[model samples]
Target: MFKRLILVLLFLALVFGGIGYWKYRQFQQMTAQLTAPRPPATIASVEAKRESWQPTLRSVGSLVAANGIAVTNEVAGIVQEITFESGQRVEEGAVLLRFEDSVERATLESLRADRQLAQAQYKRAAELIPKQAVSKSEFDIAKATFDAAQARVAEQEAVIRKKTVRAPFSGLLGIRQVDTGEFLQVGTPIVELQALNPLYVDYALPERNFRELAVGQEVQLRMDAYPGEAFSGRVSAIDARVDEGTRSISVRATVPNPDGRLRPGMFAEVQTLLPQRDDVVSVPRTAISYNTYGDFAYVIAKGENDALTVQRRQVTTGRVREGWVEIMKGLDAGETVVRAGLVKLRDGQPVTIDNSVELKDAEVGKQ
Candidate 1:
């Protein structure tokens, strides 16, 4: 029994010795891994520099006509002729439509004959009154009759002029609605006239931005119909009162439309160029990293052997224009920053920059 107990003790000792040796082997492997040097990461970066950048505020709006008028008949008559074609350009005072003036012309002629007869009677009566051949009352009655006939002629002339419908202003005529010999009533719409040489763009500005806008400020305009094209103009008018419900002010800009390509009611994107900020800093938009915490970017700092160290920075960004953002704070001039590959990075991670092709300011401007 004593010999059996000694053999069992030896077996337990062997098991414990095997476990300790295995643990020692694991420790040695971990130690070697910790001592090994990590490889440098590949990344693209750009150097911060100062450039003249004009900031712009962007909004959406629509194109409108500066002056649009609906041509209507002033007198009720039969439509005699439509002198102008649809979509035709007409000058001020050009005839648009003509109503039948047979009745009006006859009335004018009849009043003229009566005026002539009254004038003869008045002349004859004046001669006799001065010579004491006729009484003063008879001469006075003749003079009054002459004046009434003259007034009747003037009234009929006005009615005849109203028969001819003329363009009130120089503009392009819309579709013609009346035909020859068709009877029209007073105030009936004949056609629409729109002046397109100079266009007006209307948009609403938020109450907070009201202070930034002013008369004669330069603005940029873009239409979805013509992509990649930009039109320039200036603010011509601003609403004096703000809307009580929306708290927004209506703004109008005058754009030169010499070619008459811009039409009324076209959707447009507007950008107001506010005054340049003297103390604002800006950065490429790609440098910014957005997360749950906020927006962040990695700035390159010098490390050992001229290598770069990435230090994460929190930035307060303002307006973004042409793929660049105006930085309110958290960055400075002459600093270097990582441009790409920022997703696979940390606060203090080491990075190796491959700047064979640097980020050009012109390329960034195009975006």
Candidate 2:
């Protein structure tokens, strides 16, 4: 009975061990399949080329109206009539506001009548002096009196003219500050008038660049209001003297804003174009990848049997132009850079070049 029990135990152990070995073999096969090599990934690429790109100096600026002023009254009076509504466009010499001028008008009429009487008296005095009917001193007094009356009339006319406010120049008006029947004191603001077309952009640059700046240098502006659109103009004026306090020079650029879309006081990014274009290795902006490590780009590496692979290369980038970025370092002209279709790309991984999309990018470069 003891021998039969030991035999039964040995048989059971052998059966269980065979089942464990089969399971181990199955796991090994699954692991081998999971570790199989993958096919090469297809990607679109572009060739970095040395191209002529315009160089520019960058700065922040604000838009200014070519002509801007707070329309004010010179003489005090009640606002009788506002010929223009709020935010109205007016031409030069256009009547904007008028004050009650009844008292001034009446005074002017009286002065005119008195001036006529003085002229007649002066004429009579001159004739009598020639005939010896009046002394020289008497004629002189008569001439002085006539001149005083004429001066009074001229002064009254000027006072009447001040009652009516006219536009000093053609411009668009801001909100009305005074209502009808409101009394406005001297120098009280009526409205803000700004010439919208041909705006001026005011910016400052370091005094070191003074030697490089010129009156006709081209300037471009980018505003927050309008994205992807650039307003360009020529440098109209440069400040006569550099500011001693800030050690900077103020620059003014005149931009043609025919549609009047650009308003005064809008903040903008300014770029002044240099006279010469620079030869740089330029690639599409998409080719660059920015990460915590650093900026990098994928470059195509050709291998044996015409096989293609990608090498992740660290690059130093510079300013961006129309649609390309300047490669300052770690890149060379005429090298292929992966512009798109990066999927699970590793260092030295096999890749297939698909020029279908790359051809479109080349066409855009021509544009």
Candidate 3:
């Protein structure tokens, strides 16, 4: 019985040993495959090039009419007529509203009649004085009466004119605030008037850029109301003082609105074009990798065995124009950068350039 048990144990041990050896051989093969060097990753590359770059200062702004105001009545009166319709464009001195001026008109007429009588008396007195029929003191008294009557007439005429409200300038009118027969007091708002053409845009810029900003600098604007469209203008005025709280300077630009598509109070994105620079180097925006640490890109460098290797480079980026970005520093002209396949890249990793797709600065700008 003991000999039979020994034979069973030997068989079991041999069977287990064979299974372990097979597992060890499989592990060796897998490790060898995992340790082998991988082929170079295929990537698209673009050469950094020098281009004419126009540096821009971006800001948020609001559109304002060059001339805008709330039309108001200067005197209190019952509104007899509203000559302007809501949203109507009117010219300067155009009668917008008329009050009940009948009483004032009658008063003016009566004063004029008295002045006419006084004028005739003054003339007869002058003639009589020359003929020695009237005393000099009587002539002086007649002249004073005539002057007083004329002054009263002039005052009545002014009161009559005040009853009529005229537009101060050519502009578009808002909805009427007062209707016909509605009474309005002095300084009561009638309507809002805005000059749409040549609209003004008010924006602010950091005080650091104050030296670069000046009147007549070109500006590009975009508004959410008008998507996919761009408006342009030139700087018209700069504030004399910087804002103490924000350390920014106020700037105003005038944009032509011949079509009148732009309206006041619209929010706008403003880009103030600075002077053109010829020394700026630019690259395709796709080549840059943005992270919380900073911006970086992978530059292609020569490697051994005629192979191309990627070296991670830190870059300082500036304004982005279209699909390209201005490389402010850490990159030189003529250096090749990986435009795509950035995720698989590592420092000093080998790469194969597939020039099948070439990215040019002009082409990126068109995007």
Candidate 4:
């Protein structure tokens, strides 16, 4: 029994020894991997240089019609004729609709006949009063009768005019709202009218930029419908007060849209260029490494024998335009910065510059 126990102990010792030897070999392999030399990373790079950049403010604007309205009838009447078609362009005071007014027309003629008779009587009374043939009270009565008849005629004419609807101003009309023979009540809509040659753009900017805003400043506009086409406008008005809730000031600009391509209620991207231009150090937007702590970029430094190494730099970025960014601080003009392969880079990491891809990317950005 003692001999069997010794054999079991020997087997246990061999098992543990083999396990320890395997673990030691694994440790040595990991140590070698940790101390291995890293290879140089190939990255695209570009040189930062002085660029003339204009500071611009960007916002989304809503297009509005300079003059827009829903045309409505002022009086109740039965529609007899529609003179204007849907979507027609009409001039001011042009006839748009005609309401049934046979009764009003007949009334007007009857009043006119009564006015003529009263006028004859008034004239005869005037002649008699001059000769003392008629008393003053009788002559006054005749004058009053003539005046009442004339007023009745004028009143009937006004009623007839109200039955006919005309365009209040020259503009394009929307779809026809009322059909011929349809009864319309007072304040019933007839159609929508809008002047389309010129449009107003309404947008707001932060109150901090209020001092930079002024009337007559040029504005640039872009819309998805017209890709690559930019619309120009001028700042027409600015609100007197800033909104308390948003801390923004309202602004209005007038854009000429002669072709009527820009319709009201369309959204557009608006950019306002400041009066001053800045000479700033500019770099490609791709070169920026945005992080939660801070924004940074990798700048290449030349070492002995012209070996390139990347130095991580924190940057204060300003306005960006056309795939480029303005570097406000932490970098200088004429410095080379790594433009690509940023994910595999660190501070003081060896890198090799490859401009073949970088040059092609720059040309594409320009286009």
- Estimate the TM-score of every prediction: 0.80, 0.69, 0.79, 0.84
What is candidate 1's lDDT per residue for 127-246, written digit by digit as tens? 899799989999999999999999999999998889899998898988988889899888888899999979999998888898889899999999987899999999999999999999
Which of candidates 1 and 3 reaches a greater TM-score?
A: 1
Q: Which should have the higher lDDT, number 3 or number 4? A: 3
TM-score of candidate 3 relative to the true fold: 0.79
Backbone clashes in model 4: 0
Candidate 1's displacement at residue 197, Å, is 2.0
TM-score of 1: 0.80
Q: Give one digit per residue, the lDDT tens place, for model 2 in 1-367.
A: 9999999999999999999999999999999898876568778999999988887878899999989999999999998999999888999999999999999999999999999999999999998997999999989988999999999999999999999999999999999999999999999999999999999999999998889899999998999899999989999999999999999999999999998999999999999998765578989887887657788888998888978888899899887988799999989999998887664566787888776754333322111
In model 3, where is the ten-residue run with the lowest total lDDT?
A: 358-367
What is the lDDT of every predicted structure here? Answer: 0.85, 0.89, 0.90, 0.88
In model 4, the worst 10-residue window by lDDT is 358-367
Task: Please report the candidate that would top lDDT against the real structure.
Answer: 3
List the RMSD of every prediction in angstroms. 5.3, 7.3, 5.5, 4.5
lDDT of 3 by residue, 300-354 (tens): 9987777899888889998898889999998999999999766656888889888
- Candidate 1: Cα lDDT at 94: 99
Of candidate 2, the 10-residue stretch with the lowest lDDT total is 358-367
lDDT digits (tens) for residues 78-138 of candidate 4:
9999999888989989999889999889989899999999999999999999899999999
Worst ten in a row by lDDT for model 1: 358-367
Q: Rank the candidates by lDDT, best first.
A: 3, 2, 4, 1
